[model samples]
Target: MQITNEHNEKMAKMTFSSVYPHYVAKVESKGRTKEELHQVIAWLTGFDDQKVKELIDEKATFDTFFKKAELNPNAELITGVICGYRIEEIDNPLTRKVRYLDKLVDELAKGRKMEKILRKA
Candidate 1:
């Protein structure tokens, strides 16, 4: 399904903190470490562990969270299917960014190698 602006706006208003635990649980359930989850987030958004925690503590919305992000130049390298949607086919910029994070977390939970997940240079 194509992502609509309404969907993007709704997702943008969602709290990153509210969604963080699910990401953590998904990875941990698959035997991955919280550190690995943080690593992927940091690699994608340029927020270190401390900054990530601070954003969570502040209850930052996805819009606010991504607004502060310095997305990696290699973010374009993140390509795959997520929730039945192809990442490269997503048209909404914000939704694409959100899906990028989702795809990364999914990859981490699925035990994809860190180098591959990070799209190593």
Candidate 2:
């Protein structure tokens, strides 16, 4: 799918806090705990639980959230389609990061194993 500049701008301005609840609901609806979701996030973004809460509290936009993140080296290992776009093919860095997290959460909600979700070797 072609990602437009407008799409990138919309995603960049989206708040992590706004998305966090949806992530929680998605996982929980699939029998995954919030902790598992947090674990997946921490694996990719290196934000511990407390830091995640703080980010949510601050309403950090995707741009700000990613800027503050120390993304995992293994994050590059996350690949495949999410939101109708290939994670590996997204050219905008911020949009790609957002989709990486989305794909991980999708996997979590789909009952993929935690190790696999964490991109374990």
**Candidate 2: tens digits of C-alpha lDDT, residues 1-121:** 8999999999999999999999999999999999999899898889999999999999999999999999999898989999899999999999999999999999999999998898786
- Clashes per candidate, residues 3 or more apart or on different chains: 0, 0
lDDT agreement with native, every candidate:
0.93, 0.94
lDDT of 1 by residue, 18-114 (tens): 9999999999999999999999999999999999999999999999999999999999999989988899998877788999999999999998999
Inter-residue clash pairs, candidate 2: none
Task: Output the number of the lDDT-best candidate.
Answer: 2
Q: List the residue pairs that clash in candidate 1.
A: none
**Alpha-carbon RMSD, each predicted model:** 0.9, 0.6
Clashes of 2: 0
Give the per-residue Cα lDDT of candidate 1 at 61. Answer: 93
> In terms of TM-score, which candidate is strongest?
2
